[model samples]
Target: MNWLRRMMYGRYGSDQLNVAMLVLSIALLLVSRLLRIRIFYWLSFILLVLCYLRMFSRNITRRHEENQKFLRYWFPMRERWYRMTDNLRDCRTHRHFKCRNCGQKLRVPRGRGKVSITCPRCGNQFLGKT
Candidate 1:
């Protein structure tokens, strides 16, 4: 453990981008094995190598910048994914609707029959069946 710490003392270490790359590499490897695709196997190997290179890099600033750029793209997509999953999980108890006037997403309780929805953003009233 002491030797490992010494080895990584000046390294950039792991960041979100590296972790994501590692996960994607593993997923690609699994897909390659399942589909018997040689290209995916190679791609996964390349990604794995890149992940390790980034982890052991000595340029901390560059690694930080790369992680920031990755986050800028990853956060919004991640939020959308979480929102979709949450909506799926809540499908039994809630209904989701978009306001036609302002396109704001509104959540309404399920089995409410016909209800009037007021958009809080623009105060747009719309009727929908829940």
Candidate 2:
């Protein structure tokens, strides 16, 4: 499939790290079969999914040339960074904290606060001491 190679080879740009990561993941998957490590195999499969997710996720989203250098130069690896933009946006909106017992995400007010919080999910009681 020359079209497939041409399509993959020249879009935005290319990445050695992603290619290396993909290759490493495939190798790990193969090795896990020999080593009988189920976790390694599952993790290798997950990494492969992440590699593909990194590759084609941009087709569904918008891209900017100025703000994202990699998105301009090599778009395939931009998904993780693109996903982080939501977290960065949330970080701009309010304060984020973790629960002590269950590590739940708690978003409090953006400013200094003397507030008591109970995590609804974990029922952990803690003060918002930020």
Q: Highest TM-score, which number?
A: 1
Q: Residues 1-130, candidate 2: write the lDDT tens digits.
A: 8988776763433245457568889898888999988998988888787666656545423222322554355565566778789889878768877899998989886767677888989898988865
Which residue pairs in candidate 1 have backbone atoms (N, alpha carbon, C) closer than 3 angstroms, thus clashing? Answer: none
lDDT of 1 at 93: 92
Query: What lDDT does each candidate get?
Result: 0.96, 0.70
Report RMSD for candidate 1: 4.3
Give me the displacement of residue 73 in model 1, in angstroms.
0.7
Across 13-116, the per-residue lDDT of candidate 1 in tens digits comes to: 99999999999999999999999999999999999999999999999999999999999999999999999998788998989999999899999998989999
Name model 1 segments beyond 4 Å from true: 95-130
User: Residue 21 error for model 1, in Å?
Assistant: 0.4
Model 2 regions more than 4 Å off: 1-76
Reference-based TM-score of each model: 0.74, 0.37
